[model samples]
Target: MSTYTPGESFAHRLDPRSKLAVQAGFAVAALAHTTVPGLAVLTGVCAAILLAARTHPARALADLRLLLPFLVLLPVVEGATLGPPWFSVADARAPALASYRTLLVVLVSVAYVRTTPVRESRAAVQRLVPGKPGRVLGTGVALVFRNLAVFRGDLRRAREASAARLGDERPLVDRMRLVATAGLARALGRTETLSLAMRARCLSWNPTLPPLALARVDVPVLALACTLFTWGLL
Candidate 1:
């Protein structure tokens, strides 16, 4: 739940488009360079980006805790064998690297989300793209950003209520099903409410958005993004 926090940090001052570019470029670079040494470098870059956003690495990881199980499971499953030589470190290496790469990309994205406001992100998208399609994409981004935290909160409350009802005594599968069903129901209810609220507020495709502009400080960041993209391509 690393939603935007009001701050005067360096990243906060950056144009949303530049921040988006950095995310895109970092993702490309991460995908292109998944080796040990390359990942090490990218790790440093990721840390630097987090620092620039005034975000702690531990906090970012904590925000991503929900996905950690899958990240851990992938390599383990890939390395496991049905026969003789059992688990192969060789078989696991590539997937392990790939997972770590994914982690880096996600961390970068988290940094972006933490620093950039949902409206600014929507404005950036609408500006970059045009017509009804841009508005559609922008609306989708805004809804995802705004609702993600609410959805997480719903799931948390459902889990807590389940635990209070002695859900811990239930089978693991049953507990998961209960939580998932509760969360889904809550989410659907919220969606309907949100739709009504939007209609009441006269939600428009061309709502006035905050102005976005690249400052002198943004030049270096854009340059860094370009450099990362070029490095990835190379």
Candidate 2:
């Protein structure tokens, strides 16, 4: 999904630090539970968070399309490897639980990503972590998130151009190779240009991040997050 969708929802107004905390705590708690009911509760909480964030369910599902094949294959592979029967319902439980937990984590992360801006994320990290190192780490992280969309766009355009030129006549492998080459070239070029720009601007080890303020609305969300996390742990 787009790292940050512009919205006026309560989630969008919450501090990024709160979102990060909730995501981390929820992930840790969710992983400890293996039961279907427990996972279902965790998934429900994530879904509620998404709803609170005003995130479109369709958009979230669309973003996960890239992982659908892996999600489908993981349970199958896990079930097959565990026992004699290739598709035992018993064998599938563990894998299914694991996959469900993973999905919950992704959903929580998507909620944070959709609501918080990259700058806010950086500021959150910076505030939580003291010193120049925190600044460096936070800036690095924000830059990565910022650049991810650009990289995706580059790959997409490259593939589209390749397809248009070749008209699907070329073999799949050839098309993939061409796309990969183009994407790598574009990434490298971007890196070089970015490096030069940073150098010209006199890159600092400790860049300033904008300040983040948590308001009253964040309290209820924080409380909900804590409740969910504790529930998952129990």
Best by TM-score: 1
lDDT of 2 by residue, 1-234 (tens): 458889999888888988887887788778777787778777777888889899877778787877767877888876775445556777777877787788778878888898988888888888888988788888798878989889889999999998888736898888888989999999999999989998999987666666788889878768877876776567
Clashing pairs in 2: none
TM-score of each: 0.97, 0.90
For candidate 1, write residues 93-118 as lDDT tens digits.
99999999999999999999999999
TM-score of 1: 0.97
Off by over 4 Å in 2: 80-86, 232-234
lDDT of each: 0.95, 0.82
In order, what is each prediction's RMSD in angstroms?
1.1, 2.3
Q: Candidate 1 has which clashing residue pairs, if any?
A: none
Clash count list over all predictions: 0, 0
